[model samples]
Target: MRINVLQHTPNEGPGSIATWAELHGHALFTYHPYQFGQLPTAVETDMLIILGGPMSPNDDLPWIKAERVLIQDLLARDVPMFGACYGAQQITKALGYPVSKAPTKEVGWVPVYRQSSVIPNLPDNLNVLHWHEEMFEIPTEATWLFASAAVRNQGFVLNHRVVGLQFHVEPRQNNVREMVVNDFPYIKGSVLNQTAEDILRVTVSGKNERALFAILDYIIE
Candidate 1:
C-alpha cells in the first residue's frame, strides 16, 4: 500500500509509523509543507498520516489552509487517515468542527483514559506525550475515543477509517528531544506542563509504539 504522510515540521516526522510501514512492506511517502510549501494534489495514496506541528490549524497561513483542503478532500474520498496533535486539530476543523484553546496547555507525559474500546489492545489508561495549547472538538459524526484531564477531546474516530489523536504516540526519544529543543518556548510553568529535563529523562517505551501501531492497523484493516 502507498502510505503518504503530511509532516508539518522537520522535528515531527513519522517515527514508529515509518517502522510499521516498513515491517508491513508498504511504501511510505512524506510531504513537508513547512519547508517546500507542497502537498498532494489528490488522494493518490492508500492511507494518509498527518504528523504534529507547532502551528494551529486555525492559523491564517496559506499552507495551513491548503492542508485543511487536502484533508477535506481525503475525507470526501473516505481515505484512511491518522492525525496527531495539530494534525488532529486540522482534521477536526476540516470536518466543520471548531478548534479552540483548551482549558490549559497540556505538555509532557500525561495520562489519557480510553473512552471506547473501538481500537483493540489499547490500555484503559496510557500516558502519552502532549504539547498542544489548542484542542479539537469531537465532530458530531465522530466517536470519542480518549480524554485527558486537561483536555476532554483527546482522540476521536470517524467512519472507522480516520483516527485523530491529540498526543504524541509516534515520537521516539530523539524526536522528543528535537521537539523540546525546537519548540521549547511553548512550554510554560503549569501544573500539567513538564520541564525539559524531566520530559527528556523519561524513557520512550514500547507501549507507545504498540498503541500507535494498533491504531494504524485498526484504521487500515
Candidate 2:
C-alpha cells in the first residue's frame, strides 16, 4: 500500500501512523509545505494521512488553499484519508463545511467519546492528546464518530474511508514535548487547556495507540 502524508509544520509529523506503515511494510511519502512550500500531485494513494498543525484551514496562506484543492481531488476519487486536528479542519473546509474557532481551546490530554459505528467495541471514554483552538462541523455524507465536552464534532467518517479526528491519537512523548516547546504560548490558562507539566505527565498508553491503529487498519484495508 502507498501512504502519502501531508504535514504542515516541522514539529507535527506522523507519529504512530509512520510506525504502523513501517511495520506493515507499506510505501510512505511526506510533503512538508512549511519548509518546501510545494504540494504533491494527487497520485494513487492507498491511504492519505494529513498530520495536525497549529495553522487554521481558514487562513489566507497559499499552501492552505492549495491543500484544500488537493483534498477535493482525493475526495472525488474516494481515496481513504485520515486527518488529524488541522487536517480535520482542512477536510471540512474542502467539503464546504464550516470551520470556526471553538468557544475554548483544547490542549493536553483530553477525553473523547466514541459514537456508535462500524468500528466495534470502542471505549466509552478515551484520553488522547490535543492541541487545537479551532473546530470543524461534520461534513455532508460523513457519519459522526466521536465527540468531547468542548467540541461536538471530534471525529467523523465519510464513505467509511475518510476519517478525521480533532485530537492526536498518534503522538508519543517526543512529539508532545516538541509541540510544547515550539508552541508554548498556546498553553494559556483555560478550563480545557492544561499546563506543560500536566501535558508531560500524560502517558502515551497502548490503548490509545491501538485505537489509532484500528482506525488506520480500517482506512487502508
Report the number of the highest-TM-score candidate: 1
Which segments of model 1 are wrong by more than 4 Å? none
Q: How well is each residue in 171-215 modelled by candidate 2, as lDDT tens digits? A: 877988888889878889555657888888877878888888888
Which candidate leads in lDDT? 1
Which regions of candidate 2 deviate over 4 angstroms?
A: none
Per-residue lDDT tens digits for candidate 1, residues 67-130, read: 8898888888888999999999999999988999888888899889999998899988887899
Clashes of each: 0, 0
Model 1: ten consecutive residues of lowest lDDT: 185-194
My TM-score estimates for the predictions, one after another, are: 0.96, 0.95
Candidate 1 to truth, TM: 0.96
Clashing pairs for predicted structure model 2, backbone only: none
Q: Positional deviation of 22 in candidate 2, in angstroms?
A: 0.8
Report the alpha-carbon TM-score of model 2 versus the true structure: 0.95
